[model samples]
Target: MRTLFSKCLVAPALFASTLASAEVKLPFTLDWKFEGPSAPYFLAVDNGHFADQDLSVEISAGQGSLDAIPKVATGAYPVGFADINSLVKFLDQNPGAPVTAVMMIYDKPPFAVVGRKSQGISTVADLEGSVLGAPPPDGAWAQFPVFAKENGLDMSKIKVEPVGFPTREPMLAEGKVDSVTGFSFSSYLNLVRLGVPEEDLTTLLMADYGLALYGNAIIVNTDYAEKNPEVITGFLTAVAEGVKDAAADPMAGAQAVIDRNPAGNVELEAWRLKLALQDSILTDYVMANGLGDIDVERFEKALEQIAVTYEFKGEPSVSTIFTDAYLPASELLMMK
Candidate 1:
């Protein structure tokens, strides 16, 4: 009888050892630097969500939303976070790239035209005659034409200054540019930190103004996804759990980011995380339907909107762009 009990204990330990040995290393790339919006991914690592799925995830920060598509397409990184709209353009240009979005993260994209009210720019129409600072590779800048077209703004009248990402916010703060294109939560909070009053800022979120675009999503190298189907599902399941936990305790999520970024302020990051949760992540559609999935109708409409500005080399299809086959059952994806 003693031997039987000993065998039971040893069996559990052996299983654990085997599971640990079977863990796969997945390198993940993010759409941007370590900030409040990126806390959930870090939380996934810190909270053992990835470990629970037998994945060892190493996260690296990216320069912009467009940065990770090629990295994942080339199979350099198995998975990455990036703008879905940019992915559409990339596949259209590259034609048969091995990368596609697997999960929808930002239901309501944070793209916006952020301007100072004091600079006589309180509305979208105010942008017509203003000097707009836009980074060439920015996802928001890429979508600006669609926003302008929907709002009936004449682009020819607007003075566009091509600014680098580092100088984007500062140029607006220093009055060099009246407005800039960027993610709403990121630009708004950055300007606040730079001594710009909250009231002085006018953030015209494109979604609020008739843009039907979705935002960043979890993208994967299709070749990698095909070879390891279970790994893709497990990675997404862990990501869903991480997003849920981060939404539940935003301060904890912010701490995870701060731990990774020693220079990050916990208070600021917490505030930023909350803004993302409210503005982009936990939208009405997402809260009702759960995370990591998209409404087919909405996604199709978004594609039509993307076509407004970009001249596609070939027709884009929903199936080629995203697939929910690797997502866990819907029950596990519920945030609230």
Candidate 2:
């Protein structure tokens, strides 16, 4: 990881002779498990992408993407990554949580329905009236019904079966459910790794069906961004660079993550991550535009729907739900 950034840096002696540097501290509340898809965030730290912009960051795990929003709003973390749905809920429930979005991370939402070709199921339409598998607690299938209406899907027609977590891959192979709902980056790729031929499987993207909403995002407290705008901007700039690097070379990023772990399945995690990058939408969507990028207009559409679902009681617009000052970096990183 150090080697990568060093390749891009100007010679130290010349840079030192000409420039001035300042140190800044920042805290990040991670949106996923350590060394998973969030590996790029670790890459950003290990490779000094944060340091290049005079920002230093401390990263800690978050239970779910949704959980990060409240933590950032409360100042437990100056900035964090989260899903679009939860942040909207937080704003409606608390009315005082000052969270806002930084950038849109996954251009194509990661939601998908997977089925084995051998099972004779090959499309989202096939799941109509068919049994569908879901990860019990946070399974994408359970998230399906609430998000389904937006996609023009008839969620009531489908039978949802609660499947154990981390078992979707094999269960699909064994014909447990006709299809399973999950993120392509995590669960689906696990199936591919276990020798499920891509040609023998069908993946139907939920986003194509109108379930299009931002999945991962970088978030910060609106108050902190208002006061220390530059620091937030620099922090996101570094994070974006890290996202870019991860896309260009996931192996390096995965290795960087593996290098950080002290014990327990380092190699297994690394291999799985590499497979995830190869088959996941993460690289194709997020790589080109940079990471943590959010579209307000797109977000507003989903936010309105969720607020109505949760009975926000007609509170307010989602425009104030997030801030982009940090991730866009339209100013500071470009300025002298």
Candidate 3:
């Protein structure tokens, strides 16, 4: 009886060891704080999507869209979410930073110049002589020049104020600045939280004005991706599932985010998640081509648009910056 019991214990221990070895530890970095858009990922965690792919993913909040680019480039984290345009410039400066976008989110690109309707910023032309608060590292600010140029606004006429991310909205609410550069979903909701009426906000979406730009994407360290292609694929697969789940039931996704961030307002964050889904994530192209893919032709035009504002050290190739080789099947990626 003692020998039989010992044998059972050995089998269970080995099984435990196998489970531990089989699970790949992957830490994911996000572009911003825990908010509505982040819900899908939390839902993925709650639903065991990562575990289904034999991955143990840990998602951490970020400071801004540009924050996670270097984290992944340095191999400090294997995968990260960041602005793809920022990645383009980083690659241009670093020459070979080992970071490239694998999955495209924010298909419509949330970069926008948000102004208060009551502050004489109802039109893009209104920014010509108004105070514009801009965060230096903000993804929207990074693309503001393009937005300005496309809209035929003289940037020289626009009075720019450099502000911290935390103060960007507050300053606007207090009438410190007439306008601000930020993501549409983020800035719009932020002002709402600051007691600004929804009707008083004027969101000048860059994409609507003629900037053919892509937004944030899942970026990976090339070295890490090369060594662990399967892991990258699994991570993306799990993320796609998360996005789908979020789209299906945004409220549930918001609940997932609220679970991790108790301070967040569930109703507001749910609406925010819904805003991201409708305005940025689930676009006509995304819905038609399925998620985790991009139109090469449109991407090329976007690269050309970026080149207008940014000088590239080495020639940038669309294929080099992004790849769909690791994407799951269309059925798995289709959000609909």
Candidate 4:
């Protein structure tokens, strides 16, 4: 069954770009295969929002948030995507990681425990003692155990099987494992494409488990943000406009993603990203509070969860991770 971002929900998109028509340079990276959920970034570039911001943008593909975060911090790219879990860990260990968020692309974290509904999996409790799957447990997605524990799950009972990424989707469908880890944009939709009905799938995302993992937060170095607030605002303006356009028309947005997928399940996963976003993205809070809404309360809550899970001593300071000075809520004005 199609979710909110399906064909039926798409309306005519508004493409008013709130930027000057000139070339400005902004380099960026994508954390995974370019498809579906990556739409808004591509849409803004395609629709000339970046140009309207007087910016010329370049997009590159990195393996995942793990790779992108360091690159952004080191200036390999001025902007990149990383979920909240990584940010929490980085700030805990190295107070000088030098990154702050621009916007949350996905209002709900997409990391999820995916399994066959046929396996009698209804909740995290049902998967007790079950072996869920993944490739490497060393990277950003490693937060799943913390996610599991946050939900009152006994991590010792739930085993993690390191099945390589290539076989991740089929293994779950074939019942090769009890459950497997994947993003809603990547795995859940691929399952539907492989003939599993949406109703037959069970997903327990950390977001639903009270862990509130923030995915694909557009990030820039703190130093860059301090000096080039206008550039940051310009990027935010382009991104926010693209998000609105996608929410208004997903097929066109999915097409933006499909154009970038070199291989893999192109349209199938694109459709899923569309569904996933509409199910819980483009929040009223985001639109109402203005583009790139950074909820300070939510950020602190995530830090609190991280401190509990990782045993950090105390609250990390606001200066270590976030700075609102880059984005004035006043300048977040969309092109009228």
Candidate 5:
């Protein structure tokens, strides 16, 4: 009995040592704080998806969507989650920065103008005469110009209140602002958390109102990816697995987030995760074509729409901004 017990202990220790030695350390940066949307990556870590790929990924929270672009470009992080539209402008400005989106996570895009019905902001037209609270650095705010132009909203009539992320929802809740530009999932839930009734909240998702732009994606350091192509492929495979597992049981994903951020309310975050999965991540196209891939023609049209509001030094190409080269098989990307 003593001999058998000692052998079992020795075997586990040896296996653990092998795992530690073989694991590839890859630090990943996120577009925002540890929240419901961030749960899948945490699930991947907790569920050993990354381990299955021989990767040891450490996730770091970012200031905003644009924050991770420079981080990965500078090689501070080999992988990151960020807004792909922001990446288009970043690449255009930087010229040759070694960063590109490897996977498409937010297929429908979450950009929206969230307002309180009590504040007289029930529709897009209501925004013209009201105060719209917007964080200058927010990904949703960045695309508001296109939304306004598409809906024939005259910017001159709208009162633009530049508020910080922390103050955005509070200001809206306090009736200091008529509306706010933010992600549909984030802002709606934030308001609900602050004691606003669901019926009182009016969400005008940009994607629903003529905006065809894609949303956040997993970006990779091109320099690193070139040398470690297999690592990139493996990393994406693990991420897909995480997304599939999380979608099947969203509460599990929410638990993973709460485990990391104990301050978060599990029920609220679980709802947020569900919103992101149902409204943003899993779309008709993603369901049919599988995840991590984009329609090239639609993407080109999105760039054209962006050009209407943003001046470019050079033309942006879909190939340069995003690639499926690092994506896993179609079967792997299909959500369960």
Candidate 6:
């Protein structure tokens, strides 16, 4: 009986060892640097969610929202995080690129025009005649044209200063530019850290104004996905669990990011993660319906909005841009 018990224990241990050795290495690329918003992914790695799915995920930071699309399309990376709006444009330009958004992370895009009240900018109209600092590659900047059209702002009147990502918030903080384009949570907190008073900032979220668009999503190489559907589904399932874990205890999520980014501030990252959860990730729609999926009707409206500024080379449809095929079952995605 003792010998039988030892074999039982040894069998499970050997099985676990086999599973560990069989883990598929999936290198993930993020849309931006390792910050608060990126914590959930890190949590997935740290909390063993990826390991549970037999995936060994290695995340790499990206330069901008558009950075990962091309990398994934070229098969440089199997999966990545990127702006869905940019993915639309990229598909239009490239035509038949083997890349598509698999899961919707940010229900409401954090795209916004953040300005200081002291600069005489309080509303969207104030942007007219003001020097607006914008990074050309910024996802928010890319959507600005649509926002302007929706709000009836004459683009010709607004002086757009092409600034680098690092300089965007600084120019606004130094009073060089009246306003800047960036993710609301990122720009607002960055300015606050720069000694800009919280009350002095005017954050005009594009979603609140007139823009109907989705934000950053989990993207995949279609070729890779086609060959390994189960792998993609498992990856997304792990990510959903990571998001839920982060949502349940934001500080833990923030700690995950800080672990990866030793230079990150725990409190600040926690605050940032909270803002993302409150404003973007945990929306009413996501709360009611669950995560990692999109409302087809809303997605269609977003595509129409994108059409206002970008001329599509071919007809864009829900099937081409996004698919729920790789998303886990509804039960696995629900967040409480």
Every candidate's lDDT: 0.92, 0.68, 0.89, 0.71, 0.91, 0.92
* TM-score for each model: 0.92, 0.80, 0.91, 0.83, 0.91, 0.92
Could you give candidate 3's per-residue lDDT for residues 203-260 as a string of tens digits?
A: 9888889988888899999999999999999888898999989988888999999888
Per-residue alpha-carbon lDDT of candidate 4 for residues 1-336, written as tens digits (9 for 90 to 100): 777676444432322233333356889887776777777888899998887888888888888777888888887788887765676677677667777676666666777788776886778787777777787853324667667667778877867788877788778877778777877556777676677778988877767788655656788987777788899888878877777677677778888877776564555645766766654465555556555556777877776666655776546775566555555355453322
Q: Candidate 1 residues 1-336, lDDT tens each?
A: 579889998999999899889999999999788988888888889999999999999999998766799999999999999999999999999989999999999999999899999998999989988999999977789889889889999999999999998999999999999999998999999999999999999999999998899999999999999999999999999999888888889899999999999998999999999989999999998889999888889888899999887888998999999999899999998888
| TM-score-best of 2 and 6 | 6
Candidate maximizing lDDT: 6
Q: What local lDDT does model 2 show for residue 57?
A: 81
- In terms of TM-score, how similar is model 6 to the real structure? 0.92
* Candidate 4 error regions (>4 Å): 1-22, 138-141, 262-266, 284-291, 311-315, 328-336
lDDT of 5 by residue, 63-171 (tens): 8777899999999999999988899999999988899999999998999999989989898999978999999978789889988999999999999999999999999
Q: How many clashes show up in model 5?
A: 0
lDDT of 2 by residue, 1-336 (tens): 468668557577567754544566788888766765677778888888887877778888778866787788888888888876667666777777678777655566566777776776776666777877887666355357655666556878888887877776777766777778787656656687778787877777666666545566678878888899888877777766776677676667777766666452555565656545444435444444434555567667666555534677446565666555455544422211
Error of 2 at 301 (Å): 2.6
Better of 4 and 6 by TM-score: 6
Compose the digit string of candidate 6's lDDT tens values, residues 29-139: 998888998988998999999988989999999987667899999999999999898998899889889999999999999999999999989999999999999998777
Error of 2 at 97 (Å): 0.9
Relative to the true structure, candidate 2 reaches a TM of: 0.80
Error of 5 at 278 (Å): 1.6
Better of 1 and 3 by lDDT: 1
Please report the TM-score between candidate 3 and the true structure.
0.91
Candidate scoring better on TM-score of 2 and 5: 5
